[model samples]
Target: SIEGYGIHGNSAEWSIGTSASLGCFRLHNKDIQKLFSLVPVGTPVQIVYQTVRGGIDLNNNTAWLEVYPDIYQWSNPELESAKVIQSLGWIYEPHWQALGNLLQAKKPLRVEIPRVIKIEGESLDIDGFYWQQQVYLSQKCLEVLTVNFKTLRADELFSGFVKLDTTDLPGGNSQYFWDPQANTLRIIRLKVLLNGMELSDAASWSSDHRLLMNIKTIAAQLNAKFDWDCVSKAAICNEMKLVGEPRDGVFWVELEGLQRVWPQLKSTWDGKNYTLELMYKKR
Candidate 1:
């Protein structure tokens, strides 16, 4: 029942997707000129007479704001006076050194976002790149895997969740080494101290619990990229260490009774870059 399906007079529904136009199918004019060359002419072309007025709202409920990409506002200026420390989506070099310390402290940066959404205060400038439909007022800066809570130490806590301390990798070892606070591939080789020999042998506790379950599955896949839960509680986490990097390496661990942890790899340099830290510790 496309309003009494076609051939009524000439045409009654010209609905073309700012919302609902892909319903009754029947577009041609080179597919309506490639869907009007993919939108952008006062952009908010929402039009719906029914089907619940396609979620009704003719800008009467407020939500159509528009500030588009004009970067020529000299941009960010220093987004709300810089210092937001973490929004890490993209824009490297810590938002260009926080807009170079807010332009050497002459401050007055801007970075606001809301979306092409507003009604109680109508505003529009159309033609946003030939109507691909504007809705973009992005001004992001100060980025590069940041972490410096005003130079932390008020009992340190948020260097983006401090996980890279790697105490110089278990002290350049001859043994006891398994490190990855970030990266340096010092994988596995359980010894338990060999000046006298007695790491509770069983072939070094089954090759150190299979390399502590491969370093607890590389610290639960790098703390599951933040959803955190870097597992590895037992079977042999009694610490086997190299910490990661010190001219070729190896470290392993094991306890047993039915707990498992294994994953090992190391090679950290930190003198400038070369990183690969991975760690997991628990009783």
Candidate 2:
């Protein structure tokens, strides 16, 4: 009699919430129809007499353990607490390990919770550099420093941003402009200067308004030979290697990485202005 627990329809709809089912569980026709279409035939259905269940939220943000009265008087109360603790291990173990590591280190624990980005009430992935604040680069903004402002081409495979050539532009303002080729978005002010001259169209502001530039552009402007190994995804400037990779059709290198490659490189940022300085013997 206890073996027949498969879902079935019953005439007694009033006893839906209580333990009125003799052995077979009853569901509304619509609910059973929905489940019938979704679940495969070999799915296992556990009918535990215990009144406690534990679960962690799908996002892993919250965990829960709840207990109710053993309405059927079928479960042993002596082992129920242990069962609940064991069930909650799936959620508690990872958290406990992290806490234990911090405690053993004998240092204060600091957690960096990532901030969510939203635009016009729609959520977006937070994938850009975040320092004092978050910095995101738009394709239009990056194009400003590459397109007509500098001699660069957009890689057809990636095609989201542009690349630069070592060609020089004389008498042009050391600033960058974003042109869609068919239209122009806006122009960005240059924060870096080279040889007492403002670096024309090499550096621009990211979406967070933080200054960003390509290391190759700076190297070329400084007359350093910049070569990219597409196969290895590396940047070599004047035989000095700097780690770099292509992103959305644009190759970029970190400012600190450039400093590591060229020790003579010096930079000063006075809140309002950013200036890069270097001294080399002209040959």
- Candidate 2, residue 201: the lDDT equals 47
In model 1, how large is the Cα lDDT of residue 231? Answer: 38
How does model 1 fare in lDDT?
Answer: 0.25
lDDT of 1 by residue, 1-283 (tens): 5342231211434553223433344454465566666864344444432110011123432111112232235444335222332332222223233233224422222322211222111122211000011211111101211122222122121112212222222211111222222112222222322122223221222211222223333333434221112232222233432221111122233222113323332222232221223333332
What does candidate 2's lDDT look like per residue over 66-138, in tens digits?
A: 4555666777532553465466654322222222222222222232211122222112221221111222223
TM-score of each: 0.15, 0.30
Give the distance in Å from residue 244's predicted Cα in candidate 2 to where it truly belongs. Answer: 1.9
Candidate with top lDDT is 2
Top-scoring candidate (TM-score): 2
- Give lDDT for model 2: 0.47
The per-model lDDT (C-alpha) reads 0.25, 0.47
